[model samples]
Target: MAPTTLVLNAGSSSIKFALYRAGDDVSLALRYKGKLDHHAGDVHFRITDAAGRELTAPDAHGHADDPTSALLERLEPLLGDDDIVEVGHRVVHGGPDFVEPVQVDDAILRRLDALSPLAPLHQQIGLAAIRTIMRTRPALRQIACFDTAFHHDMPPVYRNFALPDLGADIRRYGFHGLSFAYIASRLDAHQRRTVVAHLGSGASVCALLDGRSINTSMSFTPLDGLMMATRSGAIDPALVLYLQRTREMCIEAVENLLYHRSGLLGVSGSSADMRTLIGERNAGARQAVAQFCARAAEHMASMMTALRGCDAIVFTGGIGENSPEIRASICDHLAWLGLRLDPVLNASGAGVITCDRSEIVARVIETNEELVIAREVRRLTQSRH
Candidate 1:
């Protein structure tokens, strides 16, 4: 059996995994994709082949030290005889230290753990998986592919803040870079000036000029850009202070409120998922969807300005690629900018959705962050040999 490469993206309650067959020439192709969703006391594990066919329905129950260990235990037997030679992780933050993907070591793990405070929701979970992999497969090489690395070279002017006393290292370090990088790779010559809107539960917009990240909606933290499913994005600092003084809320409570209880859930008093919000025929739900569209449209215009002018707008992520209604709404708002969407094409899902006569082109492209991670793993590991 040829050696396979495993790519892991660990979230707070979910771990997305992909296995790839690495060619002798350093090319990578996805073999299997799966996810483990742990909620309450139940553990749901499912795996599918590259063609979306179910290969195994493994019985995954209970938890060990963490979900990573539990997931690895269930997945080991399902891999058959394929040997996993290397592992790659989608680490959300590398701070100012790491500008490229690096092989994991003891000191590197410690440095990544120290960055937990910057990205509380993501770092801890990712580290847990990394440690679990280390314990389980000590012989396997692991790589840390940072989401912040792609935007590390953005212009200093856009990266800086207005604070006078702020240190040189403190600046806007954008997130969703892996997604942006994948989208940037798919752009053609005419789409040099593109605004890619990645509208998932956690959303952000990025402007790429000649495939380089010039500006993005996300700032120092992922919570600073577009309002997400549960995150209150881009709120005034004064409001937080007012809540502390008047509402007697502590720092932790305020953080919890903003990061876990706001956005669509707080606004609609319903579920956080966009599909749920769209299905509900209520004022609150409708208003919630409307607010998301409006805020996304507003940020997209700002991103376009960052590119001087937009040649094309590419939409990816959960809501961006699937929800035709949401896409139409956002395009309608940008109609004044000479963007015209074909209803038939938009509803059909994928490819160019814009009218040929439109001044600007719009496309729907599915992002593959795992492929990028796997490629990086092969590149970095092969370079060492």
Candidate 2:
């Protein structure tokens, strides 16, 4: 039978699963991709084969309360022993220790549970999914893939908080590692010391040096760094304190505003979706785009400090890959650094959409994080005794 690896990305309200087959020469390629969305109107799931051909049409269940269980139940009919061999899980926070893929066990589960506070939305869901899997199959070969692993190479100078090391914590550990790592691994073939703009609704940048993470835009948590769809991005903690002192606002409320109600949507008073905002060109829409471009360039400068300079700037994610307007706006500010986005190529969906002669190159490239996770699962599972 062909070897198969299953990769799971467990989010707060969704669980995305992908099955990949490790080819005869050990090349990992996706076989099936699907997702289960919960807490919505109705629990719905759909799966597609490697070619994205629908393997199963949309299936619905009326108000499935548990997302993990909902995902598991819907997935049961679609998978069999011949379909899945090993599993890879996306764990958001690895704290200070788990910087590499490791076999999941009791100690790892305990640590993941403890780190739930660091990534309240993601980690809890990851643990919940892991628990559900454990209950469903007690002896499955599973591995924990760390989102912080790629940033583990950051120097002490870059990682430290400068305020007395507090119990090996309070240090900066970047997120979106699996996505960033997939990009970083492929960057060397494209350019040296490249800056990757992962501009989704939730966005961040990673500066790659020689195919390793030198610096990244996001710091400590996803809420820090650049302006996102809803995240405030690198706001002054003093503002929260002031709100608490002057208005008696609680921590949860402040967090909710900063993490959920701010950014493009907050300022736009319209929508977080960039394409929608860009279309309207309203005062709020213009402001949101301007703020996004400004903050992106600002953080790019910081990441450059780690690499002295960059050879290229690669754009990925939903907005980064599709929105030519945002790409143009960002490149406008980067002109001083010699980045000139080729208008014809940028609009045409060409992969390397940068002016050939431009010194600081800019291009768009779609990322495949599930394939990366599948590779890790294959590697770890193959090593098992």
Candidate 3:
């Protein structure tokens, strides 16, 4: 039996884990995959082995109220008697300094700590999970697989802000690096320069050239690109100032509104789930889809400008990969821009979702960020030998 790599992506209320075996291909054929969900209330953890058989069912974690503590306490049983060699974490924001997958140590922890304020809600949970697991097993080797690392190759124009370089360190640190990287590796052979749409609650667009990220819609943070399910993406700073002055809204309050309040949910006054909105025949949902289409069209245009005109467009994530109506609407808006869709191909669930003979290509591709992090974890662990 090969040593296994444990990859974790800890969220505010959930922790997802995937176990992989070490092999010549580095993809440690899958050992198990599972998640502990609803930790803030009734906790449930489930795991399944390589052939998708349930190794463990949704076991209850009846513990104290604290999620982190409860999680650590419950994880003890699942981890014992395991031959896991190293752990890799899906860290949300590594900032500029961590431009690649890195083995976490005291210095790395400090740096991840410093960047927490930029992504207070997401990064801290990942860091806390790392610390919790470390304390549980002090000898375990740990690695931080960044969500921003893949975008580090973007040029200065895409990475920098117009503000003076002194305080501009807080500019254009794209999230979803692993998501985008997975998409880039699988573009259709015909795609030259392409646009990738990662449409979920936390969504953003990226332009790729020869499989490297040339420019992306997200800037400085995930909050700055296309309008997302609940996030107010690409808002003017002046509007933020206006809210501050008129409403007496503090920075934190404004941040919450931008990061958690203003997207399809804000516009539709409906649920954030795109499927829910699409099924209901209400004015709000209609209006929400309209606004979403408009914003996505605008962002796609912006990406085209950045890429000097892309040869293809790919969609991924919850909304991008599944919502056929949303995809059709978005492509309808872009028809004037030369992206013709083949309805047959688009509906067949083929890996290629675009229409025939379209000038600019479009398709739906599955993204596997956890798998990417697993690969990196395995690489770093092997190098330790």
Each candidate: how many clashes?
0, 0, 6
Instruction: Point out the higher-scoring one by lDDT: 1 or 3.
Output: 1
lDDT of 3: 0.79
TM-score of each: 0.96, 0.93, 0.91
C-alpha local distance difference test of each model: 0.89, 0.80, 0.79
Deviation in angstroms for 354 in model 1?
A: 1.1
Which candidate number would show the highest lDDT if scored against the true structure? 1
lDDT-based ranking: 1, 2, 3
Candidate 2 runs further than 4 Å off: 23-26, 56-58, 70-81
Model 2 Cα shift for residue 76 (angstroms): 4.8
Give the alpha carbon lDDT tens digit for every residue of 10-114 in model 3. 877787778777786555687677777773458776777778787654456564244445544554455546566778899999887887789888888998999
lDDT of 2 by residue, 1-385 (tens): 6667778888766778887777765588776788877765678777887787886566667646566666655655655555566778999889888987888877789988898777765787787777877877767777889888899878888877768657776888888888888877766464878888888877888888887887777778777899999889898879999999998999999888987889999999989888888888589999998999889888886777788988888888888889888888888888888776789988886877778778887778887777778888777666763
Candidate 2 CA-lDDT value:
0.80
TM-score of 1: 0.96
Arranged by TM-score, best first: 1, 2, 3
Consecutive 10-residue window with the lowest summed lDDT within model 3: 63-72
